[model samples]
Target: MEPLYQYAWLIPVFPLAGAMLVGLGLISFNRATNRLRQLLAVFIVSWLGASMVFSFAILWSQFHGHEPYQRTLEWAAAGNFHLMMGYTIDHLTALMLVVVTTVAFLVMIYTDGYMAHDPGYVRFYAYLSLFSSSMLGLVVSANLLQVYIFWELVGMCSYLLIGFWYDRKAAADACQKAFVTNRVGDFGLLLGMLGLYWATGTFDFDVMGANLETFVESGYLGAGMAAVFAVLVFLGPVAKSAQFPLHVWLPDAMEGPTPISALIHAATMVAAGVFLIARMYPVFEGIPVAMTVIAWTGAFTAFLGATIAITQNDIKKGLAYSTMSQLGYMVMAMGIGAYGAGLFHLMTHAYFKAMLFLCSGSVIHGMEAVVGHDPILAQDMRLMGGLRKFMPITSLTFLIGTLAICGIPPFAGFWSKDEILGSTFEVSPILWGIGWLTAGMTAFYMFRMYFSTFEGEFRGNEME
Candidate 1:
């Protein structure tokens, strides 16, 4: 059973290998080899899906009800700092691993069908595999440094995937904007890492947690320093999670393919910020002012995102704002010392949100085929209506997603959001009130986008 941890690293390794294979295939093969490219793409995604199932089974058995699983592999050793690549699979990371990989697999499947005629099919699958592998590595990382490495890798893949249609100026611009904005957050995260190394003499999370009290009590780590470091560290979460002021890039990110949107917005990239907060829970808890700041920032972002979403006419942009709002809720939960609850929301959000994006993709594909347009116009809800009459399957799935995101009872979203609200109430009544208000606003905007997109008369004439 202990050896199972060694196999854990293989999960990410397989996808990385798949990515390399597909990438090389794309470069070597020409347009004449379209069939080969498609076959390779399918193989890469299939391998990743298989690896995820294997990893999940092992993780479930090892950490289902037992202690945290830690596996360390010696990497580079230097004076005063011994860097070892390792992973900590506790309840949190275990759950994240499952969510990321599963959502990624589903998105890839949806992509296969949606992008069947795309010229860059092989390139698309390669990027998808790379993104999944990076996200998996980040989730299971035991140290901040390792997490940072994979974090940047995920960002790079996001840039590539979002700008996949590089011929389109908007897609190129959106990718650049997202890349540059996230770099700002990454700078803050790097500073925090350096601060941690300076204070604790190590970058390992477990070591930092164990020695945090000693460092603080000895005055080596004061409240002011903690607060500053916490704020710097949280900058990454703010940008990555699409929190207020840094949230502009997310709505524009809809310029990418719908499948890419599902992968980035719903499953992996956006979740990285929440994961960071949970990873550093102990260190942040020791700084009261930092926690309060986190709580207020998250609450405000939630409200702001929900309000902005109401005004967005683009379907994907509306969902993008909704994602930011939901992520803010998770951040608030973490700030209020509800780590488990935040994680719960993250889990549920992954399922329903991915479903929503994929369903949107289906509708977009149908519209493209029906309208005989060179470029699809699915993003603009103003150009869409009566979709239920045209694509019944997609309509039903989209309704389920809408219901789930609205936090209606019996759906996954309701369970997670309620838990987050319950946790917020424990900390402050005012914060709880803000969260509830945001929830209601989320419901209103989501249904507005939904009804306007699918329930009204078709704004364009039917194809002859």
Candidate 2:
């Protein structure tokens, strides 16, 4: 069992292999029959399920007091520069392994149902497998360069998945918008990575942490320079996490399939920004002004997302804005120096937000029966009402997810969200006030979406 951890590299390889198999299969059977696709789906799910199990095993080992470990195989070198390929398994990596693997595993299964009839069924699973592999690789990356590589890979996968229906003009437009927007932030990230290496003389995260304070103390890294690097590094998260001003791409991402919304936007890819900040905490913590910027940015993003959601009638779009708000809440937590709370919110948000999106998928799936799959009409809340009677199970689960996101007690979100507010109040009451108000609006708009979707009279024309 102990030596099994050494084989942990297989965690990511399983899905990558599954993706390769599916990709090759597509070359031979571009339009695979339903049975063949189902078998392929099962294979993909099984491989990912193996990854999930390995992730939990690693996490379980960590919980039992196994020390953090790193493995490296030298990949490249030049004068005063080296690029190594490997993984670092610490508490953060373990936690993210579980989150990314679990959410992705579940979403893959959901995809089986959601994409049952689509021509792209097999290809969607392949993209998902690849996406899951990218995120896992990012989570366990040993160095900043590796993280950046996986980061861009994640972005590429997002572009591919979001535009899965490339023939659809909206899907093509949305994917391009996301790609271009993320490129802007990636440019900043590239600069910051270079700056960090310049400041610390290495791109290895642990080495950077070890050397950064020494450089600062010796004046090799000045305060002004550090602040610039900090802000540039944060831009990656700002755009990836859908923080305000860089947030326009996320809501528009609803043009993709619902499972993509659930997997990429709600649970995994969007959270990458928050996860990156958490990983780079040492760098950010050394700069007070940068921290203040993070906190306030989070507060404003939260409030703004909530306000916008209230006006949204499109179901996924409303949930999209809600995701932005919740992500803002997590970012605010990070800004206030509440690292644990911020990540706790990240974990809790993953489950509930993913559920909420899937529930919306269910609603839309049901609506297709009545509206004949007119994508716009099937997704409009104005056409949805009293669906609790028609979709009792989805309604019940959706209500549970709503309560969680709204911070109602006994739900997973309550404790995490309460901790964030508590931590914020200790730092700045004004920020806490904004977060508090956002909470109220979250409740109002969520229930408003709920009532508009599940309560009152059926608003669509009578079923034929």
Candidate 3:
């Protein structure tokens, strides 16, 4: 039997193919029957299911001592300058593959039930498939150029999906906000990539790692120039991960559908930023000043997000800020040089945060059924009360997510979060103090949202 890594190319292909087919169906069959729609949903989901299985199998192979895999085909060349299309799968890519494919597969399944009555059913599926494919491509990219190509594609997919409900003015504006804000970061990313190439003469990460120190020692790459390059690259993650000033766009992104919120805020887009910093660890490690900047940025963002979440009344916006806070924790972990702990939190956060958003989606869905089409009234936690009787499973699952995010014992989040806190304490007790306070606030606001929505009497006005 062939090792699963050899078939890794199929992982991204399956989703891209599903997207093309569904997109063609949308154009060809405008008035698709219920049966036809169901079939399309099943077909696209099965494709992702296949990708998920393969992703897991590949991850399994990696754990069992499989070597990293790479396949490169030259795309362009001018003298010594060459561009290649390829993928590299090692520990990081393998982990991301499983995370992206698994969460995407589950989200699509949930969306089938959630969007059953919506007019954009087929289009939504197509966008999701495209989104998954772009992220998959990004994780497996072999070089900075490949990563950048897929990076922009991922951003474009986000823009499309965040505005999926284009008729809603809020959704339209939110997508634009996301797009423009990210462009600022992307320009920084492009400049950084060019600087790296100028210093090292290649975009391949492994090559850059091997040659960076030699270049710096030989006067080809100055220490100051290297630090500048690293910081410019850092801006990409600062914005993409919703760090500080760039974070304004994410809360507004709640205007989009909830699944997109879960995908972007939880696992894919925001996660990409931290993942980039992790991938480029060697360069940043050399610059103590750059590392300090990252650590403080993450520390401040964590405190800010938790404090803001405490003030939110809109359920989704509350969760959005919570995501921002949680992401800050992960980035702080990266900044503190707790690489393993940072990634541990990323994986744990992916599962629980995605669950929290989905649980919130279930609540909003139920509210719409009872309260009619009042988006504002439906999302207001002030109006939501005594919902557990109507949604036992969602409430229970949501509580589990609440406890997990709050870092309670025996939960996945506790172990990961504890690791980060321990690492933070060793680095700076001041930052650790902030992290500890943020943890307390996290518990308070999460339970506050929970009690407001799931306890006491139902306060919502019912539809006639």
Candidate 4:
């Protein structure tokens, strides 16, 4: 590992500092004074943007696929067993740092336009900064224990951002729901960590991969026990990523501000789940049962999410379900042993999905000014039409995002989806069939939302 790789630990520091400065003690920024909010935004955008630049520097300096390396500050140890605070940088972590930081910095910029008038604007930036820190930390965590710690941090940030407008009952409830549902998965993940420790007495991913035989042949863990550990670990991603039955809370998350929606759905919250699986793939591969379950579960979630999206009239909610469906594809690809395919989709999906959600924010922002500031009425596609005539740029960009997610030809999604499906066809033609069907449904529902919101005459009541 190069000396420059040691700085990976610093990528999250600026944001945490910005969060503390913006919050300045976890209370409101002098209760809605715009100047303080403005100042805080400057601090955050400066710090987070700097962090992004620093991360890109790491990417540039460490672009070569190097052996795994770590920088640690020991936290605890029981003789031979150890716990530490640190980062693990490898090829994957380098790629993810670039993706997470890039999207986060852009979201901060977009928040300026979308959240300027809100009273919690200062605190919102505070939370956004912290969210970036948590996610970047999660990407480079050295072990399952560090993963859990930063995983919970990101989840906390999600709760705060989702419930940013706490005065609204829906926002408050959605935050609680997202938190509690994720807890169910987090507990399982914790148990998985504990089980791994019991079997091999280590928290480092590299150490665990080196000792898989000791876990099995040493008689400390049976094959079935290994599978259970893998399954328990996988449960976290399922809930966090909003797969199948645990997916109910995602749509309700629209109660938050829309850039936060992009933050959660596209860049940070849900993406963390898939990233974990990819990071842990070496361990996950030892258990066939875990892989089979993950593959089928992801396939079903993709299909189910697309179908429900077909009926949604709320624009953000529709995009939320689309995220759920897209995440499913990533998980399914990983399950079927298409590691590169899964991650390729994850990287591409982050770009396009964030664009789609931000464009939704732009639409809502314009409608609020036009329709007297009721978000519910503004976001309801039943009342929206012919928006392309007025907001042509947002409409055109949004259509490109829609096409990308729909796997249309010559778009980012088409290449990734084809790769996942190609990998799936080799693993299971039946699953590939399901994936293709979901892709068609994705195109249908997306176009449905697009036309209803931008093509027809305004279905909204005459407010002028």
| TM-score for all models, in order of appearance | 0.96, 0.97, 0.97, 0.96
Q: Please give the CA lDDT of all the candidate structures.
A: 0.84, 0.90, 0.89, 0.87
* lDDT preference between candidates 1 and 4, better one: 4
lDDT of 4 by residue, 178-231 (tens): 999999999999998788777767777757755765677677679888888888
Order by lDDT, highest first: 2, 3, 4, 1
What is the per-residue lDDT of model 1 for residues 1-464, given as tens digits with 9 covering 90 to 100?
66776567787888999988777766777564466876786788888887778668765775667577788888998876688888777777778878888889888888878888888887788889999999989988988989999999989999998899999998999999999999999999899888877877777776785676688888867867867877888888888998877887898788888899999987789999899889988778877887887888889989998999999877778888889889989889888888888889888998898888888777777666656543436566777888889888888888999999999989888999999998888879999999999999999998997887789898746433
Better of 3 and 4 by TM-score: 3
What alpha-carbon RMSD in Å does predicted model 3 have with respect to the real structure? 1.7
Clashes of each: 0, 0, 0, 0
Q: What is every candidate's alpha-carbon RMSD to the true fold?
A: 1.9, 1.5, 1.7, 1.9
Error of 3 at 429 (Å): 1.4
**lDDT, residue 397, candidate 2:** 94
Regions of model 2 farther than 4 Å from truth: 31-35, 462-464
Q: CA shift at 369, candidate 4, in angstroms?
A: 3.4
Question: TM-score of model 1 relative to the true fold?
Answer: 0.96
Residue 452 CA displacement from its true place in model 4, Å: 1.2
Which 10 consecutive positions of candidate 2 have the poorest summed lDDT?
26-35
Candidate with maximal TM-score = 2
**Pairs clashing within candidate 2:** none
User: Ten consecutive residues with minimal summed lDDT in candidate 1?
Assistant: 370-379
